[model samples]
Target: MGIFEFVANNIYYTVPIPVYVAVLVVLLCQVFRRIFISRRPSIMESTPLAHKTSDLSHYILKSDSCPALQVTPDTTYSWRDKPQEVPREIKPGKYFLTMNIRKLDPNDYIIFDERFLSEYRERQAIIENVGPGKIFVADPSDGGALDLCEETLVVTVDFLVTRYPSMFRKTERGVFCIDAGEEYDLVTRPWSRHPLEITCLLSGEDHILIRCCDDGTLRVAAVGLVYSLNIDWRSFIGKELGSIHKDAHVPFYESALQKSVDRYFQKLPPDKLISRANWLTQVGPELRNDNFPDKYLELVSTLPGNTITPETIVNDLYIRVERQAMRKLPSTNGVVFKFRVYATNIWDLEQEEGIPRRFADHIRGLPEPILRQKHCLECADCILKAMDFMAEQQEKEKFMNSYD
Candidate 1:
């Protein structure tokens, strides 16, 4: 303990106040440097510059902005200026110009107003003619050769109206160009009194022509272009009929007569029915004629299965003849007739009543009268007439069967 105490006391004394003060001063300098001297801004603290500027020059210079004056590079002319002094006057050389409006931001459009910008001065005359294989245009008098460089080539008003529908709309009698910028109503004068027909010739872009016609038939050429082929209905019908005859299973004469009658009836309007008076006038004598018996038989044999009896045959014939007459008659006074005949054979059997009398009674009981007085004799008389005809046919068939 004595030795440690002695050594501690000596060191405390030897390490003087000056040495402690120097070490404290050195520490203070380091603290001061950290607080005030060493702090500085980093490289990342710099200000940023803008990449783009807001420019509105395009929006300011619009067609609508200055309505009276045309803002062109060569010359600006106001609408109030004399028409003759305006640069818009048609000159001799063909020219086209592109016009841009600020409101339509994305696109600029072109217009061909003057055919020649230099030679014609103001008034231009156009002479047009159709040649053998080309179209030629010149000035009628000799002011200057017509120039079409700036002009829309061979374009008709119709073509322009069709191609650019939004640009043109139809009026009551004509068409006019639409102006998106101003209210100027612009309509092109027709080149001639007649309508102009524009067609695209076989050759490419260079081969368009304008043909003028008085009648409004210019659209026909366009229709022909769209539909190049034609169809004939009569030719098709003939071919179909020939095919039917070629494939027929029945005799040609019989099949033809049946088909003709069927077709004729099919063509009749539904409201009309054949009648007895018309049947007798048109086809009854033909059926009874000796020379036409074969034809008559051919026609009759083609009747439907239910029409075997003489009464049914006569009814069907009357229906067909009435239909034909109604189709041929004018609307004014066409008489429609109705008739019926029924018969039964009274061979050596119990004669309760003749079959014809029973059939006639059935006809008479129907809701509608089968025959009016003018169209038929007495009902008994009509029934007897049919009976006589059937009896004759039956006898002939019997005689033939006996001989065979």
Candidate 2:
């Protein structure tokens, strides 16, 4: 009352006493909330740095009964959370024409989702059948490659434990994977295999470790890239960025992206974790298709019954998105291009809330180079017609609901 009386008398602009009291109450409530509430850190704040794994050779064991361990990025994901992130990344009315790189949340550096067990088995089968040498290629000449392999092992194990505590318990014996039903003593390799090979089986995710050359170009020193985007991983093992992109048939690298990418790598600090997403369409449902130029040619075939019409495009077309994150290793001075592939049928696009029309528009808006890069040029007409039809139906439904 005294405070209100003082304010009322002192201020030239007279405010009501109740208004003053209400403002005071709101300010007090905000103060209390700030004192009690726990908030996520602001963007400018540093991500919680991962703790290095201790020897743990004789550390006291924590009980696994009720999950004494905790997990972060605790937003639960499942098979239903199909990773066709195109719809989410596409702004409400915005479309991207080029690489839309963004700062990645460190917690989201690796996503161990519902597909863990299935993908683990699938990647393992590839190893047993196709041979590990084909998938996990390492440079015997580069010492940094071995350093990257070891440090990657440590980082991956630490991540699995920290991000998924209950499932991956780190102890004296190494990591105990609940889903894999076995323990991996990768802490001290048994001399049977390399650390990169062990990490290949650790999760479904893949990586290519990049080492900087004295000439300021990034070189692919090693890779455990199994889920193929039609690139021959073997050919890329020793290639520099230019040669790799030339083999990749990567569009606009020399003209548009090479200089910027080179500069980014040189300027990148070990402390920054960044990510970007890229996507394209394929003819088949396979997630690991290494068949390249031929696959693009197959889409344009005019052969009887083989040509994809608007109707058949739904079942035959598959969309694959690679969500990639990169971090420059402080210890190894190598950059880890960590990524995972998520594939879905074209039918899934129509079912997504903001996909059909927006995606169709995005396709229509794509420049020729991007269209060729995405392999959408040959089938663009059929894809646009089909999605535009769906968009029309959606509009009709909205029109019909206006009376209600």
- Candidate number achieving the greatest lDDT relative to the actual structure: 2
Q: Pairs clashing in candidate 2?
A: none
* Candidate 1 local lDDT, 1-404, one digit each (tens): 69778778797686888998999999999999887633643211211132221111121121132221122221232222322211111111222221110121101011222221311121112112222111222222311111111011112232333334444434443344453221111122222211111111100111111111133111001110101112211222112232433443323423345445334433443233332111111123221112122234356678887344333334323211211111111111111111111111222111222333333343344322223311332233444455455455565666899999
Give lDDT: candidate 1, residue 381: 47
lDDT of 2 at 329: 70
Q: What's each prediction's TM-score?
A: 0.14, 0.74
Q: For candidate 2, lDDT tens digit of each residue in 201-272?
A: 675678888887778989989988777754557767768887778766777777778878877887788667
| Model 2 bad stretches (over 4 Å) | 1-88, 91-98, 188-190, 229-231, 291-314, 399-403
Q: Residue 270 in candidate 1 has what lDDT? A: 27
Task: Please list the residue runs of candidate 1 whose C-alpha ends up more than 4 Å from where it truly belongs after superposition.
Answer: 1-368, 377-379, 382-386, 395-399
RMSD of each: 41.5, 13.7
Question: Which candidate number would show the highest TM-score if scored against the true structure?
Answer: 2
